[model samples]
Target: MTAIQLESASAQSKHEATLPELGLVCITVSQEVRFRTITRTRYLQFDQKERKKALKSIYEDNLQRLNSALTFCEKHSIKLYRMTSNLFPLCDIEDRIGENLLESMSADLAKIGERAAKLGIRMVLHPDQFVVLSSEKPQVVENSINILQTHARIMDMLGLPRSSWALMNIHGGKSGRGKELIEVISQLPENIKSRLTLENDENAYSTSELLEVCQNAGIPLVFDAHHHICHEKLDSYDDESVTEMFYAARETWDNPDYQLVHISNGKDAFKDRKHSDLITDMPSCYREAPWIEVEAKTKEEAIAHLRDWWEGET
Candidate 1:
């Protein structure tokens, strides 16, 4: 099989004449997002001193990292770029509670989206760790859906074209309660639902499981390599089993829209699910998947590691 899985011609023709480039998820530059220490807490609470420090400090950051990556892409002649944002908090009750961050975020997103468009790049927002549809608490699930609704509005206001520029990366919930998740999705506005895409989680579902859902929901899927490896449901001890899992994910999506995939590395022991630097070295799976975003631990090192793989001598 080819390194990357490909989609059908009909689906490929829907996107712009240009193809999507391999994307890197960024969380490093904004230390507050990745390093959940006192600094982040202070910043999140609107502590002036800490905010000033974070704003002024210019050490390995998301903004600088994005600039460096764009320059690297320019040097390498990469046509399109993809990025993952950790800015879902604006929709969270805690983050936006008694605050107007939602409006501010919407305004800022437009500018950011415009800039990304100018740079021939697209940004996607991946649901954070706490955002889950499988939560037993009805409130938590409601909050997650509320966040999705906010995301759809943000994308709409930012002039993002449907099926491009912005996408919601969701994981299939465990507990075999995906039917509840589907009901929530079904309740979304048609336009918003159009932008919804489901991805296979590490354990909750397999590629086949995700495909089955997509077949019924009429949506797409983003396959995560590391998640697939760490999946408790998938027996990864044997090489043949691994190969079978990979093939199953690859064959799950007959449509091009389902082609996008996430690539990352994890410990074979499945302890800390950190994104390792060995992503590019692994054989590519979501071939012809229009987009591939790296879910690394830190945004800065993520790009650094990706460049090492993309331009490095094999």
Candidate 2:
């Protein structure tokens, strides 16, 4: 299936036509979201048989809920979405039971992928913050690789392209380890490397820093505007400067048209790192980005609010 369908609307006609498709990350805030999980402690308590059963149950439930999530996105006309890293919770642990857990659910995963593709939804994934491939500790690096591999496997099972269009985005962990990061990325299996993307974090790597890493690693950079402002670099969030960064980030992508930009407003102030419930403004720079993932705390509701706000402004 095609990774993404480019929007026909021109950037200048953003208001006159539909605004760039906004993506909802992980869970939804407006309703009861079912992102089930199994703690390591709880898993340890169960017998071998029970552990396998529990893992299977949780994975199945998560897949069912994911189908529901896809349907919700289709109904709302949200063409972009970020799947939860916890979808298969605790399944990545070295001591976990059911080594073939994901394999068992291949049919379910294919169905979800087919549904998403049919609905014209562009799917992406962001593993939790702990996935640090550049860690000084060997075990940490191994564990991180395991986590990333699982994410890549999920994307493959869904039949998504092994490209940035079905990006598995993460931050450039442990700032200043750019060289080590590049080395680690170079060794990654094609499944993980081909679909991998680095994002600028609020405290660690600034846009400029990660941009260099992305360039070296031959991967696309997912620019997070909120993180840029909160970063120590403290550059002006003015339209001209942010737009310049946007364009620079765009060039890193194999296909600039599929570059993914993340958008979210600070909770209390422009510099606050905590995401607010809704986006108060759309950066003029966003016109240069085709797929903008709404990282607001309100999830899909934030996209709805942004749509309303955009319409009102126009």
Candidate 3:
């Protein structure tokens, strides 16, 4: 039903394919039901051997799906994808699964990365919300570092250069902690630091706050346009602020054209934070960043619909 996956397209479809309109970045296929969606690791019967087996299988499935996703993106002309952090989820027992996993899946990772590289498709990782660096507690920060280290190792295994396309994006955790978060980011290994990007949160860090963090850390900023609409107050952030936000974010990238943005629409008027199944319009402040991750419930299908809609306007 999505516009991107149409079976029968008239002359309009062919003309639309050549237009440079919105950069609709997709995250995996939308048909999660029809697709073999694998989210969590299954410990069949909690048996030790079974647990290890399950972990290996999940890792393999994730990579396969990632390769499949890359192919899907290339076919649909979607260039950017946000990879799932659940790829390994072995952080609970990294001692057991970390190095062993690298050795086991190195080839597959390399091959998959090669596929992505060849197709000129971009990939990124958004570690879940649990990864909080603003916590004053040492263990929480330590755990967060360890998790990102694991993510860095996977990025290395994939042979993705330390760049924005192969980056680890996170939010400014615990409001008023942007400075502290930058200090933590400073201490990270060069490999991890180079690939880190900070995003503005809905309630905590606004466009103005995270801008400083990214500047200090020498990393790019990912502007979530929907969050601005949903969480930012009219009196606080003005049209000029929106313009500055986009400029600051795009400045962080090596090539300004590769700047990434997150786009989504609210499901309802009252619940603006909730992502709608389809995004019908781009924010007025947005001016076609080089890359934009469409944060819609419909996933790839939504990108297709956007493509179809954009073609009509062109």
Query: In the order shown, what is each candidate's alpha-carbon RMSD?
Result: 7.1, 3.0, 6.8
Cα misplacement distance, residue 262 of candidate 3 (Å): 0.7
Q: Which stretches of candidate 1 lie over 4 Å from their true place?
A: 1-20, 28-108, 232-258, 267-272, 284-288, 297-314
lDDT of 1 by residue, 1-314 (tens): 11021122323443753333556554334543331112345457755455444433422243345445555555544434443333333233343431243454455545545555555555466655556776778898877777677666666655565562356777777557767666666776765666677777766787667767766666666666566666644334234554455555555444445456776666354434765544544434444446667555554456566666555544
- The all-Cα superposition gives candidate 1 an RMSD in Å to the true structure of 7.1
Per-residue CA lDDT of candidate 3, range 1-314, in tens?
A: 21111212211333444442233332444543122333334443456666666677767777777777777777777666677777665634634753586577899898887777666666788988878988888899998888888888888888877766577888888888878898998899877887888888789888878888888878889888667655665322235666677777888776565467888877885237788888786655564455567888877778788777876877
The TM-score ranking, best first, is 2, 3, 1
Worst 10 residues of 3 by lDDT: 2-11
TM-score of each: 0.66, 0.92, 0.84
Look at candidate 2 and give me any clashing residue pairs. none
Q: Write the per-residue lDDT of candidate 2 for residues 27-136, one digit (tens) a residue.
A: 89966456889788888898878988899988888888888888888889888889999888776666646558888778878888878877777889998988998888
| Weakest lDDT window of 10 consecutive positions for candidate 2 | 4-13
In model 3, the runs with Cα more than 4 Å from the true position are: 1-45, 91-95, 235-240
